[model samples]
Target chain A: MDSRAQVSIEVALVAGIAILVAVSLVNINFERLNLARELGEGGEAKMVATLIATSINTVHANGAGFELTLSESKLNFTELTDVDQGTGIILPIIIDNTRRKVIVGRNMSRTGHKGQWNVSVSMVPNNVVRQDPTARYPEVTIRNNGTNVIVYADSSKVRVVP
Target chain B: MSSNRAQVSIEFIILVGALLVMVIAVFPYILKTNELNKALSAARDGATFGAGIRGVGYQSGSVEAPPGRIKIKSVILERLGRCGNLECYRFRIVIMMPSYYSSNSSYVNSIRSTIRNQALRFVYYAFNGEYPASSVIYRVNTNYYSFNATTDVEYY
Candidate 1:
């Protein structure tokens, strides 16, 4: 082949490899950023779960008549930008009576990820946990009603008496 | 034609040299930043999980010590020991430091302090009760391999 042709082929091969590397790097960075975001969301979810679990345990431990109100001040559900409400229960917080644990999951539609980024913590209260069907967000009232810990979450418009 | 080819070769050599120099200069900074982020993330996760475990342990009043393990990136967290009383306890946080920071004392100290500060702050917020922030000690041991941080937590 001619010298000019040889040089042109060499440059094309090098440029092709460079493009491939650049594309790969971009992909890797994208994945890394997504993972970091997921990790962050998981951490936040854990924090919320911890707060809820601790409250349930504390209320149950303190005996009956002990009531704790977790307004936006305590349970910052805002931190969970895209939290899943779970199946059948329209509440983000789920009290698993069978497993004796509190599970907090994320809403997959907004997260754009398929990972199970839920946070679950074991609870001491074995009694049935009743959640207000109309419960929404920003506030949750947990009360030790002598037998079971009643948990209700709803907006300010709804009465939170437990 | 010969002279033109010689000039092209020299230009190629200079271009390659410049690219190498740029990579050499920027690679360390990127690595250092990555390490710092990892350390901070580890510290935060460590504190959060540590406090969560402690909270559960406090609730159950189990003297057997809560058995749990959390792995975050290059960090590992587990039960250290029982603090005699059920309310007081310790948990171990092991953070693996890359060899990059091992050679530089300042980097090691910076990473160590970063982990210590974040861990202490989160633990205090989540675990402290009547005890002051100062009372909760975040003991950090830095070797050439990893950062071993332990916190004496009290739930009141």
Candidate 2:
């Protein structure tokens, strides 16, 4: 082929590839920003859940009755059972990604969904505790119960059970 | 014809060099803008989180922390200061709540305590302890649910 013809073909091919790469890059950035927004929203939900779990643990630790208001929060209570008078709830912060959920801190986890997190503050059994973190206080086990696409918080204090 | 080709090659090299320089110069600005935006979003979310927990102290009946689990009236951005840093933002947030009783020192003290503790925790979590923040609360009886009570929040 003539030299001019060869140069013309090379320029065309390079231009085509550049355009393709540019288009793909734009799409990638768009998706990234969308994910960032989702992360922000999920992070917000996780923060609220952690706050509730922390409140429960704090109340149990001090044996003091206290109330906290959760506003603009898309969270629901399961069983709505009070932390047992003697055995406070122990909540384990579980992080699972097969479900694509990230738990912030040990007590809170969130996913891409705008709303779908469960925090359980349950009574700890005396005999069946896989690991125990407390001797003075009746242990509370806070963790995700079942698979409701949720995370559970069961702790007399917000901590990992030993 | 040979001279023309040489001139064309030099032109292409110059064009490529100019593009490279533009990218190197502009990339930092883009990164800085993105970081600033992130900081702003984090601040807004943090303020909202703190406002949501304003009532945690009021659940007890006695002066046992004195908060019967209060309500947040409103949260607004009072001022914002921009500084030269990767995510530089110094801002003030104002929070309001309603007062059933007259503005008493004891009641105000409880509220201040509630705001300080809960707000600090909320910001710490929401911002992931990434920024330095300080909050101050003041309660004043204006009228019947006329958006009363206040907390001054400073974040850097």
Top of the candidates by TM-score: 1
- My TM-score estimates for the predictions, one after another, are 0.41, 0.31
Query: What docking grade applies to model 2?
Result: incorrect
The residue pairs found clashing in candidate 1 are A83-A107, A84-A106, A84-A107
How far is B60's C-alpha from truth in model 2 (Å)? Answer: 11
- Predicted structure 1, TM vs. truth: 0.41
Alpha-carbon runs more than 4 Å astray in model 2 = A1-162, B1-23, B56-89, B101-156
Worst 10 residues of 2 chain B by lDDT: B139-148
What's the distance in Å from true for residue A27, model 1? 1.0
DockQ of all models, two decimals each: 0.02, 0.02
What is candidate 2's lDDT per residue for A1-162, written digit by digit as tens?
Answer: 345764885698589769955653453344334334433443444454455445344433443233233322333232121122111112334333333222222111111112222322232221112234333222232222222211123343232332
